[model samples]
Target chain A: MKELLEKIFENIYSNGLSEERYCDIKEFISEKLISEYNDYVMNREIVAKNKVNTLDIVLPNAKVGDYYSQLLKIEDEEIIEYWIEGLKKTGLEVVSEIVLDFQKEDNTMVQGSANLEVFDNDNIECQKQVIGTKNKGLVIKGNPIMSGDFDLTLKYKYKGWFDGCNILERKLRFAINPDPRSLWKDIPTDKNIKFYKDDFVSEYVTVLANDKGLQKDIVAASKRGRSHAHEGKARDDDFKLYHNDENGWYIIAVADGAGSAKYSRKGSEIACETSVEYCKQALQMPTELEETILELSKAEEGYSNRSISTLIYNIIGGAAHKAHRAILDVVKANEDQVRDYATTLLLAICKKFDFGWFVASFWVGDGAMCIYDKERQYIKLLGTPDGGEYAGQTRFLTMPEIFTPESIMSRLKYSIEEDFSALILMTDGVSDPFFETDANLNKVEKWNELWENINKEVDLTDDNSESKNQLLNWLDFWSAGNHDDRTIAILY
Target chain B: MRRLPVYLLIDTSGSMRGEPIESVKVGIESMISTLRQDPYALETVNISIITYDRDVKIIFPLTPLDELQLPDIVTPDSGPTHTGAALEKLCSQVEKEVKLSTPEQKGDWMPLLFIMTDGHPSDIMIYNQVIKKVKQHNFASIIACAAGMKAKVEPLKQLTNEVYSLDTMDSSSFKKFFKWVSDLIEVGNKSIGATDELLLPTPPEEMNRII
Candidate 1:
């Protein structure tokens, strides 16, 4: 030890006694002295009888916002009282005093004087003292306010140790788990930022053609997604709901623009407006379609009528084709490529006939259109979502291949129901969360759940005046990892 | 919940024994911290790590961003870089972990793969054979990076079209590269329904994208 000290002193002197050298010397001297003192205390016969090397204090883990209490167990019997320090910030407190019973070496149980003293009492919330005198243990109890792994350096002052070595320091490591719901952050979007489009769109159009027995309440809403809002981008979804009171027909169109395309917002707007306008003009003189539908509805359940399909195709499918051509026309007028105007379109034209409610729809992409019946527990999906091999790949209206006759024919769906609870059309933003898979859209239970969730926020029983605002508020439902522009049109 | 699976393939051969391996660890830690702050990434991202030396070891399995714990990575004193074996193990893990969309269930998003190495593969023949198998998985994006001056670009070029190179294996360079990676992940999460190919974010000045 003397040789090592001399070598250290020589090195420090050669280093001119700088701050680093002084710290090194001080650390070396303290370590040497502590080891020498420990060795001397260990060799004595009297000290050997009271030598306590290890103190095992087991601490239980905790979680935020939970009332945590655990009995701390220390193995040594000679420790009469433990004065624990350095727990100022932690939300924990120890009971003042308790009597402990420990077995002696002779196997005889004896009462021992034991107590736990905590210095800081600034954040104590527990009032009960340590209970059970005979078999008492040190209890640390409080409600933790934060979540993290805490390494506590506990200074324990106990009896029955070597001279000048009564103070023992131990490290207690425990973790506090965070509340799962607290991790999600809802940062509101800046409305007046750059690249802001006119996103204030909420329509409540009531179609009341009493002579024709067509009484429908229509509400449509479109909102920017959290992802686009986070980046201060514009809402890329658009919807147009037109009720032709003259012919008792409801033309509802919803479109979702591609997120990566710069001009997709314009594409979606044109798609919805052009499709609803075209369908409105085509169905203005629908005497031929009305007769074809009446004949088709009178046929057998499994009958496939060519004239009805042709009429529905001319109305619904032609609307989609016109919307595609309109988007291409706009792209050409603006000197842009077709990809810049990529968008998905879902067009539905429904009318209440003498036979039943006839609904015809044209779907081109990943969104969903369904006729949901709550009383009968039935759901009919208009068309299958065009999900690609990957998650995000979907066919767009701007694509030339989607304009093919076979493609358009396959997308056309017509259904004649006696009545439906609701006719809902949604973009991928709403469909991806409510009905995750294409098959889920057909599941009656999924539609029930969606209706239940919507009814919780919006009163669907009566035609309430606040249904439009309630529907807009319901659009803000939180779905993790699903943040995209949302557009939905409901005819109930 | 639809997870966005991400696989990180790291080279831990003998040449990465000192500061290079330590810097890599720091780079990954930085990346994890950055990703945790993004709400979209925190909700959807799941990460897996594979290390290759004389043997390939999966240090971390597919774990969510919220629950991920990066383990300690060690390198041998001297060993060959079996990049082929690492790719083979990755193929099996992807098959077991990545879910494909079916009629009944919604699957995870197309996975993203990132490979970093400092030298040529010792098992070249196996690497060539496994390249086609890796492509069959149809990953959303596959980025291969040759780190440090001694790294060979030719070997990494055969693996992916999106190849990059780092001039040095320092902490700052790795940090910049990982920051860019986090940005790429954020962009990928939002723009999944693009009809065209996904656009990649620009790299930092410390890293160069090899065309």
Candidate 2:
């Protein structure tokens, strides 16, 4: 993308030097600001529709292509579609489709936007500053082909052939879409909790820690951090809200986007938001997780076309299903449900640093995780990362190939610096390919590299263009036709 | 809250045509909305539903008042009512959930199962096995109600002797029956832990005036 941007800039700089002076970003934003104003006004009138100024919508001639270059003004602004890669800009019956990848959390990625418009504010025709949690857009368009009578689609001709690549790694970005009080501990609660020490058990070991020591480490996961994911994933998945009212509180939220069923994503959303709600209710409404799991199971048994999502939060301290009878059993019976009834389970809490951290994470289907805080790197926490079964084996919540507490491998001592900088998680999409085998140096090496890269920050010494370019450069490096929607949350 | 799981077994057989089914739907929705208004019912009564025709379908799982939407009850488009299979299916469903229950759930015993039908089981052998299984799980209390002129009573007796014949099979009678059920549930909940037996409303002759 950087190369393409550079090429476009160079091409304009060389051939179109005459009309190019007016083509700078200052001119663009100014033009965009006007359109933003119109978008704001148009949206407001749309609520009452008839009162707004209409555009003389036009579809570009198939033959005109990029051969004709001019801006059309509607309500006073410009809309442009550039042919970054394709044949002649015009005459190429361009098919534009809108896909919004809405996750269990509500993290949405509206790719190849159609129904494009400048996002607006209240008076409807005005634009707001793009800072804080302001609703802004770089580009967006795509409304369903609702009526035969609709706006024209513009076609753009391109310079080269684009090769679609097989996914290197799969990255799923989840956003939280619940009320702030729902996920984030923003909602005030009056319930009080008593913290007590207990003998903690892992797969192969048991650690007896004092009460105070355990609380400190677990609190670490609860702290919010700055990441593009935090916002987008939060907006998509309610799973991000993992905080509490008092005591050393940390939370773990998990949402499983049902892969098979229709509207299963909503199920995932319900799981995360309600987990927090149910957990908070654990105070005065002290219902045990095991009981909640059982109730949730009973509640979901025969409801068809409805997906199941389970969110398990360890508020006081952390726990990993230790009993022979699996504490939780979240199901999606068949392919139809396996896809949408895709349930994600999360375990989290705040614990003492020396007593071991409060490890709160989720298991989507059967993807497993091995936490390496101390010694053993392959810390088998849950399911396999490949999301596959042994010898053509598969279990759809009806039958799950999960890590029963008995088969789980316990975590020992910390090997890395006591100063933990980042925590990483992967949807089976990435993990399966990464940890293929020993001497592969693929998963571990790549994770370490990606970790180090995301943690690094370019010096802020450069100008806005130069500095923004640095982030753009890294984004280019990490993303260059990777053919995967990669997302990672870094707790800074 | 003492949760009472209510399971509705409606005969979507060839017998229950038109008004009977529609009335049942309206009856359920009204019952739910009415229950929601009462704080205790809202907290305690959970409903699950099953429909039987050529096959058995668990239409609605046992869900708390809020989650239990009064389903749009539709008659079987075209099929025979295999009452036996439907009863067995209900048993299977109950067994799966009953074994998984814990202390957090509202009730320890089986839910109340209300089977309303105008015909006998398509297969008596299967029906007998289901009756025995349902009894073993103790997941549901069977209250078989005979509706319509040609009501089947003998096979229904196999499931439970607590059988009743509606005075007249009509939409109004269905409403009256469900409303009585709503009242019984209300009473059952208030008196939870006090009684294991359900509180049944009296017939018109037993009560001169309705409360």
Stretches > 4 Å off in candidate 1? A1-196, A209-214, A461-465
Q: Could you give candidate 2's per-residue lDDT for residues A397-480 as a string of tens digits? A: 212344432222221111212333334433222332343222232235445554446336522221222333343233323221
**Cα-lDDT of candidate 2:** 0.41
Q: Estimate each model's TM-score.
A: 0.79, 0.32
Ten residues in sequence with the least summed lDDT for candidate 2 chain A: A196-205
Off-target runs (Cα >4 Å) in candidate 2 are A1-492, B99-109, B194-196, B203-211
lDDT of 1 by residue, A407-476 (tens): 8899999989999999999998999999888777778999999889988988764355578888888898
Residue-level error in angstroms, candidate 2, position A430: 49
